[model samples]
Target: MALPFARVVFLCRWGAKRWGIATAEARRGITFKLEEKTAHNSLALFRDDTGVKYGLVGLEPTKLAVNAERFLEWAVVLADTAVTSGRHYWEVTVQRSQQFRIGVADVDVSRDSCIGADDRSWVFTYAQRKWHTMSANEKAPIEGIGQPEKVGPLLEYEAHRLSLVDVSRLALVHTLQTDFRGPVVPAFALWDGELLTHLGLEVPEGL
Candidate 1:
C-alpha cells in the first residue's frame, strides 16, 4: 500500500512549501532524551556517548503489576520534550530487535494501550522482516524498501506531516498527513530489542 515514489515526492514538496521553514531556534535542534519516569518500569534505560538506549532484555509482561502508568501489553516510552510547533527531526538506531515501532504520540496517549493501536499515535513498524505504517490499528505495507538499520522521523507540526527517512540512504520512506489534536512527544515501543535515540539533528537537506 505504498504510494508511488512520484506522488510521495510531490506531497513532501507541498508540505515543505506549506509549512515553510522552522524558526532559527528550531533549526538548531535540541537534545533528545527519553523520559524514564513515564516509561514502563520493566524497561531499563542506559546512557552512552551516542545517546540513550532503552533495553528490553529480560522484560516479562506476565510479572508486571496492573498499573495505569505502565504500558501493560507493550514496552513503551516517550521523550521528555513535546513538539507544539515548528519542524523537528530525530534519529532512532535499532539494534537486536525482532519487532519495534518508532513514532510520535499525543501527550495523553493511554499508557495501557500500545502505540499505533489508537487515534493518538502514528508509527513506522518493523516486524517479521516486513515494514508497515500504522495508525488506529490500521496498517499499510511499505513496499519496495528493505528494512533499515536506522530511521529518521521528521515532524512538521504546522504542515501536519510526519515523514520517515532511511538515515543511511537519506531517502524518504513514507509520510503521514493529519491534523494533530495537541502537542506530541516522540514515542517508541519494542518487543525484543533496544533503541538508541539521537536528537538535535538538523533536518536533512531536500528531505
Candidate 2:
C-alpha cells in the first residue's frame, strides 16, 4: 500500500541524514572528463596536446559568418561520465576565462540553453566580474567570497546536495538542494578562454 505523505517526508529526511553520515569520513573518488560529442558547439571544444586540459576557443569563422547577426557564443559541454549514486567531487580551474558557468546537469538537459537556465542544471556562474549561484533561471549573488581562481564542486547525489567550494580559501561558498531526477554529468558553459578540469580527487575536510 502507498504510504502517507507525512511518512514519505520522514523517510526522505532520514535517508538524507544517513547518507550524509555515511560519506562524512570516507574519501570518495570521481572520474571526470569532458565529452566532445555532447558539446553544443563541438567545433569550439579543444583539448591540449598533452590531453590533460579542455578549452572553448571561441566560434569558428564559418559558424560566425552564417549566424553573425545573433550567435549566443556560449558553448556548453558535458562530461563523458555520469553520477547516478554516491557522492562525487571534482574541481575546475578558471584562470583565463572571464565569463563562464560550471556545475552539474541532468543527462537530458537542453543543449540549446546555457547551464542554470532550466531545472535540470545548477551552476556557479561568473560573468562581468560578478559571482552568482543559479538554477531554473533564478540567480542569487554570492557576496564577499572574493574571486576564486579554482572552484571545487562536491556532489552528494543521494542527499540531493551540490556544494560549491572556494579551493583557495577552503570555504564553502554555497550549496544547492534539490531532487535530482536522474543521472547527472559535469556541465560547463564558456564564452571564451580555457577551463581545466581536475579529477580523481578526495573531498576536502572542514567544509
Candidate 3:
C-alpha cells in the first residue's frame, strides 16, 4: 500500500539582491494538475492529488558565497540528520552528486516505500505535527552588490547553516539561462505523495 503524504508548494519572488530567501504566505496552497494521462491513469481520480505534496512552512536563504562542492556538503549534512526530542530520530544524507546548478539530497526514512517517486516531483513526509507546531522563521540573507570578488566563502557559510534542518526537496527556481543572475535561491518542502494529483501554478482571473 502507498503511504499517505502531503505536498506543499511555495510561490517565490526573486529580487535584485545578490542573496536571500522568502517564505510563502500562510493558509495558501500551491496547486498543480496531473494532466498527463500516464500520471492520471496510474493514480485514483476525483481527488485533487496534485498540490504541494509536502508541508512547506517556511524558507531560508544564505548570503555567504561558496563553491558548489562546499555548498553541497553542508546542505547534505543539514538535511540528512535531525535532532528530535533531544535525540536523533533518523539519519538523512545526500545520495548523489553536486553536478547540477541546483543540487539535491534525500533524507532516508528507513522504509523503502516511505518516499515515493523520483526527481523533485515527490518526497516523504516527516514531523508533520511538529511542522505545524513550529512557527515560521523566514529569513533571507543580505543581498550582494555587484559581483563579489569571490563567492566561495559566502556559499560555504550558507551551506553550513542550511544543513541544520530537515528539508524534503530543493529546487533551483531560476538559473542563468533563464535570465536570472545572483542569489540563486532554492526552495525546500516536506512532501507527502498525495499532493501531486494536481500540478503547476494557477493563472490569475482573466489572464
Candidate 4:
C-alpha cells in the first residue's frame, strides 16, 4: 500500500532536516547515484581484544559475527585492500542491532577507541538511536531517515570527502569533508545489547 500523502511529505522534510548539512550545494553532492553495480568481495575480519568474530564462509565475503552485549566492545573489520587514490565504493547488508558503523580507516588506526574516535578513521555510525558521521573528534549529526537494510559508503580520495547513503531508499544521509590523508581501507564496527549482529558484504554477479 502506498504511504499516506502526509506521511510521505513528513519523511521528505525529515530527511533534509536530519543532518545540518549547512549548504544546499553540499547536500547535492551526496545525492549523486553511483554508476557501478558490482559488489566487491574484499572484506576481511580485523580481530582485536574486543572479542569480535570475523571469517569467510564458502562463496561468501568476509563477515563479522557478534553475539556479545558489551556496549564498549566493538566489532572492527576491514576490507582486504588499501587505496591511496581515486574514488571507491561498496555496500554492506547489516543484520539488526542497536548500533552499526561503516566507513574507511587507516590501517594503523587504534582499535581501542571506537571508529572515528581519532584521526585514524572516518565513519558513519549509529549509536543511542542517533546517526552521525565521525572523523577525528568531530561527530557530524545525520538525519538517518530510517535504518537501511543496505548501506553504501562512497569515498572521493582527491576531494577528501566521504558520503553515506541509504541504498534501498536511494537517499543521501550525510557527508563529511575532512583532511583525511591517503592509504586507507574499508572498515566496519558495531556494538549493542545481547542480540545477534552480523555485517554482510553484498556480492555482485561477477566474481
Q: Write one digit per residue (lDDT tens) for candidate 4, span 120-184.
A: 79988877777888878688788855665667776777788888867776566677885765466
TM-scores of the models, in the given order? 0.78, 0.73, 0.17, 0.57
Score each candidate by Cα lDDT: 0.70, 0.65, 0.20, 0.49
Best by the lDDT measure: 1
RMSD of 4: 17.1
* C-alpha lDDT (0 to 100) for residue 149 of candidate 4: 64
How does candidate 3 score on lDDT? 0.20
Clash numbers, per candidate: 0, 0, 38, 1
Candidate 3 per-residue lDDT, tens place, 1-207, comes to 233222222233323331222113312222223221111111222344232222122122232222221121111111211111111111122212111011112222111121222221121222312111111222122222221111110011122212122222222111111111122222123222222111122212221
Cα error, candidate 4, residue 132 (Å): 0.8
Segments in model 3 whose C-alpha atoms lie over 4 Å from true places: 1-29, 48-122, 125-207
- Candidate 2, lDDT over the whole model: 0.65
Per-residue lDDT of 150 in model 1: 84
In model 2, what lDDT does residue 198 have? 80
- Please state the error at residue 6 of candidate 2 in Å: 48
Which scores greater on TM-score, model 1 or model 4?
A: 1
List, residue by residue over 1-207, the lDDT tens digit for candidate 1: 111111111111112222223343664774556765446644666773333344534345445444344454457777766777888888888887768888888866776578898989988888989989898999998875676678899988889889899888888888987559877778887766678888678889998
